[model samples]
Every structure is written in structure tokens, then in C-alpha cells.
Target: MEPPAPGAGPDRPGPHDGDPGAGRIWLARAALLGGVLVPLVAAGLRGVLWVLLGVAGLALTGAGLWWTLAHTGAVRACGAALAVAAPLTVLGLYATHGMLGPAVASLALVLLAVAAAGRVLSPRSRAGGAAPAPATAPRHPWILMNPHSGGGKVGRFHLVERARAAGARVTVLTGRQDVTALARRAVAEGADLLAVAGGDGTQALVAEVAHENDLPFVVIPAGTRNHFALDLGLDREDPAAALEALTDGVERRVDLGFAGDRVFVNNASFGTYAAVVGNPGYRGAQLRTALHDLPELLTGERTPRLRMRSGHRRAQGLQAVLVSNNPYRYAVGPGRGHRGSLDSGLLGVLCVHVDNTVQAARTAGGRKGGLTRLTGTEVTVDADAATVPVGIDGEHVMLPVPVVCRIVPGALRVRVPRGRGAPRGSRPSADWHRVLHLARRSGPVWHHRPHTTGG
Candidate 1:
């Protein structure tokens, strides 16, 4: 076939690449507005108050511009500007007036700028803390919407259209597209905020892309069970709400987990749960089946061999291993024990060692008496098979036995709703839940805590 026509490499498109320069003019204009002019105006005659206000105003304006440019899919220069502006601004202030207060004030202003940028740029906040000024100007927020997430609510909810209308400048990815690749491309193309509309696993995939570049991510819950989203206090039922939050919501920093080289925004589990979830037939199973089958997973008899190491301790034959960046344990009702926070910088490991149904029941009951046990951080797991399928944030991957997992402290920013339980202190929610259940089996409704960390 004539060597498949010269220069026709399968991966390479022949001489007909689409024009990327088409939007350069608009990008240039937007840069002039959001990046330079806004900061200049905001920085007018900087006194302390003016400086602070200018910092905030300029930061917000810059964030808006960054998002706008991102929506239009423009080139990145804003991020570079962000990287330098705060320090330069501080330096200039110090050089102009050498005094402790001025110097400190300048530094604070710089921090404020960083925080603002970080907030807008962060995916989710630990507790909606302000954004940090990026090490570089932030690339725009790249949003990937799953129209099918939340029952095909993408268009019905008017998120993409409204985001575009609201000057968000969105790019909608088709289901057939490689999500991970798309996220990487967006980052390379200058995205600081990588937003996704999907389930927990989808969020994890997008998070993988964001983490690779140290970019912040925004999670829009558009999937069933939305455990991660609900945990983050994102409104999964409404796409419009999520879109608004994506642009206007508060930004905060949270933690993530690193298992091998892969990054996870939530918990990673294996054993019976993994097998169940991995099975294509699992989703079709009835609730009765779930009740009947789930218990058997912890028995170790039904589940295959599993070996694990946690810091100094090593454990084997674990029926299930759940390593959560932030413990997801929560009380079933009010006045219950502490729930884990998303930003606690700790990993929660739950391993099942029970070999019988009675023992499994105690573990499931969250009582300290069962074969189900809880421990903290830095764990490794291995299997007899050279490659054991692993579940990360509910997504499965094949890896050699003895998978190592560790907490990557302060790696993500998550948004969590303020809860009412902790007017006093934060304790592990499982313990508290157990206490509350003992007091009254009926239990109170679980309340959201003010802190970002969960039990």
C-alpha cells in the first residue's frame, strides 16, 4: 500500500490540523482585561486598605478571567502572571517603603492574592478556605460534563449552556473521549481548575489528571450515590447548582491518597467489595443479594489471599482493605461521635479479618468488638497472584501484589458543608454513632459538622 502513504503515521494527522490561532485575538483581549488591567485598576494608589481591597478585587477579577479564558480554551499566560504578581507586588511595596508593618502588610497581601487564586483554582476546599495564589498564574478551569451523569441532566439542567452564557466558556467532552487524556490536554493548554461532572470514580479520574499537574479540581456530582460529592457537600441533584459552585463557590485545600504512582481523591478499597463492584452483573443484584453477599466478603474464606503492611505492622488475609484519605465514617444521627474530616491529613484503614458471619456482623455494626478493625495510615497490601485487581476510589486497576498506599497530605481542595454536631469538638463519628445508637436505636438525623474533616 505504498508504505501507507508517506507521513501517514496512525497517531499523526496528515497536513490538515485545525487552526489553533483562530482564537488568539480574543485571548489576547481577555488577557489584557483579566490579567493586567484589572490588577492595575485594583492596585490604584495602594494604601493598606486600598492594597487589601485591591488584592481581593484583583484576585477575584483574575479568577473570573482565568475561568473565562479556560472556557474559550485560550493559551495560558495568566498563570505565569499569577505566579509572579504577588511576590513582585510585595517586593515593590517593600522597596518603596522599608518598614516592618509595610513589609508584613505586603507579605500578607501576597498571601491574600495566593489564597484567592488558590480558592478559585482549588477543586474542593477542606472547609471552603480561601484560595492560595498559585505558584504560577492559574490556567483556566476545564470542565468535563457527563450529560448522562444524574440521569442525563446535563442539558436539562442548563449547566453547559448557562456556564457559556455566564461567560464560563465551556468545552463539553463526549463520552467516547479519553477523559484522562482530555484532562491532561486541558492542563497543558493552561487549565488550573479541572472540573468534572460525574460519579466518584469519574471524579477520581479527573483528579488523576489534576494531581499530575498539581492543578486544583472541582467535583460536580452528576452520578448515582455521589458519595464523594455528598461528602464534599456538592449538590448532586442539581447540575445548575454545581455549575454555579464550580465558578462561584468557595475554595479550600484537602488531602489525597497516592497508591503507587496513581492518585486518588477519596478512598481505595479491595477484596470482596472490589470483586463485587468489578463484576458487570453486580449492579443488577437486588438489595437482598447485597445484604446476603456483602457479609461473606469479610470472612476471608470466600475472599482470596491478601497481604498488607502498615508502617511497621504487616497483616495478611484481609477480606477488605479500605484506605480513605479522609475517613468517611459518620454518625447515623445527632449527638453521635466524631466524623472524619476531608482535610485531616490522615488515612483511615479498615481491614476485615473475620472468618465467620457473626464476626462480620459485629464489624459491620461499627463496634470495636468485631473482626472488622480500624487503623491509621501508611499501609501496603500484596497478593499471591502477580497481578491483583485493585480498586481506587471505586475504579479498578491491575497491579502486582503488595500495593503500597500512603496519604499525600494536603493534596486536594474539597468543599464540605458546615455541620451542626461539633459546637464543641471533633471525635470519631463511628464511636459517637455507636454511643448514640446505644442510647436510642431510633437515632437522630446525621448533621453536617462545621469542620472539613469527617469521621
Candidate 2:
């Protein structure tokens, strides 16, 4: 079948798409724009009057301290004292000058501006143009749910009954069963649609079977962080709403990342992150373990020797490597974790090779210090060791040397609810260029004249 045009689909129209809520959305956008610009103008006026000197001093000091901490794995007592003292000194100075309130408000406005910018610039749903699936519900729909996932979401939400009500056979996955085998059996049993309500890892396994058998796949967001579901424009907060897809849904072809035989719905990570997740204690205390291991992973000489080759370029001694199924937008604001388009049929590769804490600090500061980011259809990584630790959609495993990662374009038919609209956090923030253009045109000093061709 031919692919649908971008933003042209049989899916339900969004609130901003000629719906009654379009007016309200426009009003909100206007408010957000005002909120972003008003404060910036006010701050600029203050800066012109030299009233922002104190704020500038405070900001610079904070940035310096943050840079210091990033460069040094361990903070010295003197450095810690300085970090505290610099902020206090700024506060005290502002308080003495009776400018504390204005300074605080300025800072708050800056934050609001950043948030508004994100909301305005975030990309709209690419799924808008996807073709509609069959209006009739699947006759033999099989849903494999993990009861333990998302703290027993299946039981809490009565997903089995809900699935049954939607004409689906529900199977609760326990520790004893294999998800891949279960999916295969469901296919053999003549299941028309394969669905899963679990984490991305489990969902990926079932999705692989569905893709291989040329069956439509439905995703129920019952995971703690349903990155795949979010990308599919499903309601992550409400798993029950996803059941609507089985009956009324749109079929979208999305790209999937593969590392050898294993498939991942989100991303396949290597180097530091993969090693950290491979630790036995990581699942229980993820943050603590990551924090404890990061210094060693970043600083120690015993770091794993990782080398990557994508196309004609090659990189080595990387601290971390993230191979996303689709390219993720990295900007200095919110809405950074989402993909612009999932069917782009390309892998997003980010390799980090920070030699020292200072370089790491600069890299974190967006200086591109020892960081290599590119897009390709395939990537091959070879580690010094015989086996390399890999993190596939948050699940850790040990894979053999020379791990090959590639993007499988349009390999999976993802079904999402017709009324789901755009997924949360998928919308792009306002375009600064457009905003500026409008601003310049609206100015009292600017005017335009119509031109005629020998009329």
C-alpha cells in the first residue's frame, strides 16, 4: 500500500484542527507568546538601565560553580564553600540594595519564557497523516499483558476485562513464560492483531513477532515510562484509553532500531549507560548506582575501549553511545526528548568521548566537546572485550563483540486510537523566526506596498 501524505490521515481531527477548541488554542498561543516576550523586554529594559548587573553577576557565578563541579569528579571543601558563598553573597547584595524582589521576579520570568518557547517550538504529531485502519475490530485480537509492569497496572485497571470487552483474548505474563514464544503461539493460533501492555522491552519482543508475521500491532502503555507508546501518540497516563485502538484505530508505519537479532522500540545504548544497567544492583537503585558509577566510568583509566563505525566515519574511546530508533531533538529547553518523525528510516547516533572532567563540563554545556552526533541507516561498534554490555530499551544484556545496529524502516504497523490526536509532549514550540517576522511586520515603522505587472 502507498504511504499516506504528511499530516493527512483518517485519524480524528485535533482540537487545533478546525475544531471549536482551535480558537482557545490560538488564544493560549498568544498568551504564551506574550508571556515569553513581555518578560524578556522588561529584562532588556532593566539591563539597558544597568539594573541587571546584580542578576548577571549571580548567573555568571552560578554557571562558574556548575562548570567547576562538572570538571572535578570530587568537589573540594573550599570549592563547596565557594559554591555556597557566591550565591549567598549575591542574595545579600541584592537584599541590601532592595532589589531582591525584582531579581527573583526576573529569574521566574526567564524560566517562564523558556517553558513557553518549548511549547511553541515543539513539533506537531507526525502520525496525523497515517492511514486509518479497518473500522471493524479484530476478530481474533491477542493482548499479552504483564501484571507486574507499572506496579500491576493490568490488575489495577482491569485491563483483561477491558480487552475482552473490546473482543480480545488477554494473557497475563508471569515470570515463567517467554514473551516471544507467547507471541508466536498467538500468531499460530490465527490471531489477526497482536497487542501488548507492558514495558518497551516486552512490547518490542511482541512487536518483532507481529512485524515478522505481517500483523498489526497495538501498544497499551502499561509501562513506567512508555517511550514507545508516547512516540506512537498513545495516552501513556491512561492505559485503558489505548484499548480503543483495537476497535477504532489508525495504522502508522514506524521505524524500529535493531542490535543484531534483538529489536528495541526506544534506543540501544552502549558504553557507560550499558555498563551501568548491566550491574545487578542497577534495577533497584538506578539513580544511586548511576551516580556512584558515573565518576568511575568517566574518570578512571580502566574504562572500556569502545569503537564505533558509521558509514565512512569512525570514533573510539567513547564514554557513551546512544543509538536511537529515530533522531531526537536536543535543544536548550523542554520537549527535547521527543522525535520529530519516526518514519524517517534513519538511526540517530550520539557518541561521547570526554577525556577529562573539564571536557565533560564543556560537553554538557553544549560545546560539543568530545561528542559526535550523526544520522545513518547502520552502525557497527567493536569493543576490546569479547563480550559487550548493551542496554536495549532499558533492559541490560551482554552481546558478543562487533555489535551491529541498524534502523528497520516502516517495519512495524502501529495501531493507535483514532481520537488520541497528538501524543502529549509531541508538539513543537513556537517558531522564533516566525515570531520575529510577525513582530517586525507589526512594528509602526514598517510598511509594504503591492506591486503590479504592467496592469
Candidate 3:
């Protein structure tokens, strides 16, 4: 099969896709080797000892992270202190050794080399890359704009005027109105296309109506954090840019994640986060509210111990969980925290289970660490209580126990302008194994093929 389009596959196009010749691959491998050697040669055995100290500091930081979940305020404060002290302590030790500048510079070089190697050597995903269908202008397009969202992003961007000029009907959600009702009314009034300019939660409500009616849906980044729009590669800074999709657009089918009966365009967060968001002070000040609320939730009389199951795999006593429509692809750099593809037809599950400092230290970089990542068609999360709290795409709600999360493949048809472009590809995690494979292979390999998961 052909490599999937840039935005439709886990391994989207990176810099190497254009020209991945053997010479470049060999150069990348050499750079990675050189990077490792430079640190060893410069730091020497003594430097290695210092680096070990740094790693110990990382372990202390991990201990701090785990302590933040403690019920005692003093313990949480101490944990925060350890997290802050780790790097400062490392810098001080280097300064005392009089090799601070050289060591830091060498570390930076090592990082650059690793990034380059990862970009070139890592394999791209080849699943769910089907070409999006071509689309024409809708006769009656309707928009539901939330004035309060994103600090009045709709009014600030003049979206209503521009959309009206483009011959689309627009309705302003004045206050506490039902978005689902407004979306349905628009469809009943002959809206061939449905769109929303609000948070992901509001978008999900309208999207469900659009999906059921077989209409195209457009998203505007008018939320506090436009997670869905960012993944779609829409210009979050310029909310108006999304309107172009109405008049000049193409169609791409993407899946929606479900927590019980509610649909979410993004991931569903449970346990600690769900409780934090439910606090009355959360919307006013998130960090402060979470700090105030965490002690009780973490040390409550009846802590909510979660049990998660997917297929034959099972995990218990997780503190929190994030379940998404498709697995998110993360890089070591900037501007890429979105999913690799929304049509992967599987639920990406992340279970965080850290009972103590040791587990926290052991589970630092995810998988086998405290944070467990997996993918399956369905996942069930249950607690000791009859009902559980959930944060679905930033909206707080309570779901019945044994809450089932599932992926609805091709459940939403999205429209974007033909001029739409993807965000910069995320750099994959460093893979020494892939680098070695490149060195051993006889011929140049620059194509993508299918793999199950964990790529």
C-alpha cells in the first residue's frame, strides 16, 4: 500500500520523506555515533560519574512528581522542592567541577544529533491513509458561535460578519443554551453543512448532530485549548482561516471517541483530573484550584481506585487515565502533540499508576513506567463507586460505573479547504535499533509500510 497522506497516518511526512538517500542515512548514523562519543571523550570517566548524579537527580524529580499526589501539604511541597532542586543541583555540581560550559554545550550537540537521527531513521506509519473525498460548496452552511469561548474569539475575529458575507447562516449562543438543539434546528432548516466556533465539548455536541445527519462539519479554534483544531493543523492563532473550508473544501472521514453516550472530539480524562475539573474554582483558576483540590482527592476516605481492561489486558489501581479516539503522536520538540490519525479505529489508552516513589522513578518515560500506553477497539474503566466522574474534552460529567470508551470509525466527516496543510511532523523518539538497521541494510530504504502499534 502507498504511504498515507501527511495528516492521516501515525508516521506522517517528516523532512526525510522528500529525499532519504543512503548517503544521508549514513551521515545521520555517523552523527549519532559522534554525539555519544563526544560526551564520553570530553566528560571522561569523571564526567560519567557526574552524569550519573544527574540521572539520580532525575530520579529525585520523579520522586517529587509522585509525592505531589500525597495527601499531606508538606509532603506535596517537598515533592515540588525536589523537582526544582534536581536541575539546579546538577548545574552547581558542573560549576564546581569547572566543566559546566563545555558539558552543557556537549549535551546540546548530543540532543541535536539525536533529533536529526530520529527524524531520518524512524519509520513512518502506513495505516488509515485513504485519500479524502473531494467536496463542493454547501448550499446552506450553518455556524454556532459561542461568544464567551476563548475570551470572545468569535467577536474578536469578526467570524459572524465574514461567514454571513460568504452566504452562510450564523447563530450566536448568547448564554447557557443547548448547542445540540441549535445544531439540530439548523439541520432541520436545511443546513447542508454544520459548523461550530467554540470549545471541543461544544464542537462534539454539534458534531454528533452533523454526523447523524450526514453533513460536513467544520471546526473553529475558539476554545481555551483547541486540541482538535491543533491536530487538524488549523491555524489556532487565526480562527477565521477555518471559514474558508465552507466555500472551498474537501472531505476527510475521522472517528469520534465516546465515553458512555457522550461524544468527544478529543480524549476523555478520568480520576484525579476529572475530580479537579469538577471543582467550582477550576474554571476561574486552574492551577490554584487543582492544588487546593488535590490533597483531599488524593487522601480522601475512599480513594477512587480504577480498574481498566482492554481485550485480555488488565490494570488496576491507576490514579488517572486518558483515552483518546486514536493514539497521539508526541515528539521531543515543539508544535506537535496531536494524534497521528483520527481514523485509526482504536482507542488509545493511557493509565497512570504510581503508588510510591520507587514506581514513579521506574515509570519515568512511559510504558513499563508508571504511565502505560496501549490501543484497542474498546476499553472499560470502573471504580468502587456506582458512578464515576469524567472530563470529556474539558467538559465535566459523571458516567455510570464500568464506563465503556469506544472508537466510532469514520463517524464524522470533516471538511477543509483544498489549501489546507498539515502541522510540522513530530520527531519520533530516538531509536538506536533503527539506526543500526540502516547501517546493516544493503540498499537505500525510503518508503513506509504497515505495522501494528508501538512504532
Candidate 4:
């Protein structure tokens, strides 16, 4: 039997397909209430609950500090302080309270029990299923790898040797040559399958060539933030595992976003992000560059005034605009960071037209007070200047005014190893509705239905 598309599956009923019925909603609410209350009641009964809370808070805070340090790299002073203070504070709390140890011990046991319960009650976890190897897999594949990306991930992971073992000719990109030219040459030399181990910028260049030649493309997520890889359900943490696709992979078609002639696998942005990325210093000091440039871009008298039109809606003097391949659910929690389906033939448009810097900061912080968002098949952006700067998948470029962004549905064919699991922290959570359905002993609350092009 033929395997389904990478993520597509049999059609099934969903909440939006039909009304979930009034009774189901009410029952869901009850279950949600119980889930919350039960935890609180248990904590209240234990006198040492305060100690457990303190430990958990410290651990979470420390984690946040580490993440900030890793991403920004300029927060050494604050990170150092937090690193020293957190442990000492925890130690002081433990010394002052004798019962704290017993409380923590009990909490650990409770957590274990809860985790086990969740594992048993949750729906079965699906394995990464295998896809039939593409015919092109037999040919000697050419892989363009960016060693500098993800802090020299290729060298650190010894990816060249692994690719050679998988019957691939690997090319490590140094500063001397152009990536797109090299990719075109490889295709001309009869490369059947093309792959890249780099960030989205390099991925886009290679993908564009592959798409034009009708070659199956493989993505190895070896970048600081592999947004496209995450959306494709590729394992971002394990770049080596991506090679498994060469032997056992399935082909799936996905949409690609275009800004004029340039293609972007992720999203493109104009305004604040574009201006900031254009700065040469952004690569070394992203936080510092953003802090210094944002004010000038937002408040300066020379700030470019942008006008955008999509369908009947028109926006003017926007401080920033982000157009993604598909709409992202900002209301959802962290788990919703990646797109669930890439075959959606629509562009996700977000326009920021703030009155002042404060409003801009609020909007950047994810508050949607002055934000205008919409989805369309195509969007047009015009600016007062003859040319405009754009950040396409984090790479800055200049384009003539009246930038047209559109979605090319199913334009790129991607291959991934069968049964490859979703990226870490990207799986959707079991919300209240799912709990209600499960309580009623019905079928799977969330079904993996095949995504169609039309809305």
C-alpha cells in the first residue's frame, strides 16, 4: 500500500466539522474544573506544599535565566546573578524549614503518579511511520552543508562522514563560492535528490532550485532556529536522523511563500525586523542591535511609511509587517509555535501600526492592541521609498516598492523518514474539549484529517 503524505491522514470528524453538542461542552467544562480543583485540594492538605512550590519556582526561574543567556548572550550580568541567587535561596529555605524535605519527597511521588496517570489515560502515541523510498534515492545525492550554521554543527556532529555512509556527496560551504550557483551546477550534473544542512536562508536558496528542477528536497535542521524544519515535523535536535530519509522516506508536497521572485520556506517581514536585520552588527549582537535600532526605526522622522492592501482591508504607516506562509495561532501556548499543516494555500499577514514606541513595545511583546492580522492568497505592500528592505527568513534583502507576497500551494516536494515524530514541544496539548470527548468514551478527540487546498 502507498503511504500517506508526511502528515496527512484519513478524514475524520472534528469539533469545527460540526457542533460538539451542548452536552459535550458542559461536560468538558466540568472535567476541566475538576482537573484544576483536584490539584489545589491535594496541595492544601499537605503542610509542606509551600516548600515544594518554592523548589519548583526556583527550578523554573533558573531555566528561564539559562534560556535568556543562551539566546541573547549579552545578559551575562543578570544571568550570573540569577545563577548564584537561585541555589542559595533554595538552600536557605531548606535550612530554615525542617519539614521541607519530607514535603518535597511527597511532591515528587505525587508528580510521578500524575505523570503515569497521564501516560495511561492519553491517546496512543503514534510512531514515525515509514514512507516508500523515492526513486531518486538510488542516485548519488548532493548535499550542501553550511558548517558555520548552528555554530559549526556539521563539524561538531561529524555529519560529512555520516552522509558519505548514506551514499551522498557532501559539499561544505566555505566563504569562497556562491551557494545558489553551486546548487544549480549540481542539478545540471544530474543530481536526482538535493539536501541541505543549514539555516532557512540557505534552505530557501537550495529549495528554490530543487523545486524548479522537480527534485525531491531534504531538510536537515542544523541552524540556530529551524522554523521551517519545525513546521515540517523534522527532528531539529537530531540533524543526523534526517539522513534516514534517504533510505526510508516518503514524499509530500507543501506550500512555499514567495516575495516577488525570491522564495522563503518560513516567513518574511518588513519594517522593524527588516530594518534591524539589515544592520551588519545584528549577527554578533542581536539584542543590542535591536535595542538601539528599534527606537530609531519606530520614532525617527525618516521612518518609512508603509501601505498595505489585502482584499478590502487597507493599512497605512505600519511600523512593521510579518507575512508568513500560513497563519500562526498566537493565542495558543508555546506548543503552537509551529504550523500544524503546511499545505494551507494562504499567507498569514500581520501588520503593526502603533501610535507610539510604548504601543510598539506592547505589540512586540505579543499584545494585539494595535495589531492587524489577516489571511489571504496574496498581499501587496507599498512604501513611500522607491525601494524597501525585507527580512526573508532572517536574511535581509532590498526589494523594489510594491512588494507582492503570495503562496504557491504544493509547489515544493519534501521527503522525510517514515514515522519521524514532531519537533519537541510542538505537539498540541489536550485541551478541555478533548478531555470531554475522552470522558464520554468517544473516538479520538482530535483526528488527523487530510488537509485540502481550499478553505
Q: Which candidate is the best by lDDT?
A: 3
Clashes of each: 42, 11, 3, 5
lDDT of 1 by residue, 1-455 (tens): 33442343553323233322212222323332343333334444544443454344345444433332222223234543553464466556645654335445544443333333222212232133343322322236677887776667676777787766644546675757787888778778877677787767778888877666776676666676666665565565764666554444555566778777767777778676776676565566744444445534543245576877665566677666777776555443553322245665667777656554334334433344323334455678787777666678777676666678887777765432233111111221224333332223221112223222222
Please estimate how well model 1 matches the true structure, expressed as its whole-model Cα lDDT.
0.54
Predicted candidate 4 versus true structure: per-residue lDDT over 98-208, tens digit per residue:
644544454444333333222222222222323334434548689999999999888888899999999998899988678889999998888888999999999999999
Model 3 lDDT tens row, 372-449: 777888889999898888998988898989899988999999987676735222334444445556556544444643
lDDT tens digits, residue span 1-455, model 2: 95543333455334334533223334444544554445346455543343445434444454445434333444634444655676677678667756566556655544444344444333333233445454456899999999999988988999999999888998988786989999999999999999999999899899999989988899999989888888777777899999998888877778888998899988999888898888789988987777666656766744477898887778898877898997665533564476656777878888888665456445444355677777788889888888787898988888897999998889998888887835433554333333343333322111111111100
Q: Per-prediction TM-score, please? A: 0.58, 0.74, 0.86, 0.68
Q: Which one wins by TM-score: 1 or 3?
A: 3
How would the candidate models be sorted by TM-score, starting from the highest? 3, 2, 4, 1
* Runs in model 1 lying further than 4 Å from the true structure: 1-139, 169-173, 284-302, 333-339, 361-372, 413-455
Query: Which residue segments of model 2 deviate by more than 4 Å?
Result: 1-135, 331-336, 421-426, 429-455
lDDT of 4: 0.69
- Model 3, poorest ten-residue lDDT window? 120-129
By TM-score, is 3 or 4 better?
Answer: 3
lDDT, residue 435, model 3: 54
Candidate 1 vs candidate 2: the lDDT winner is: 2
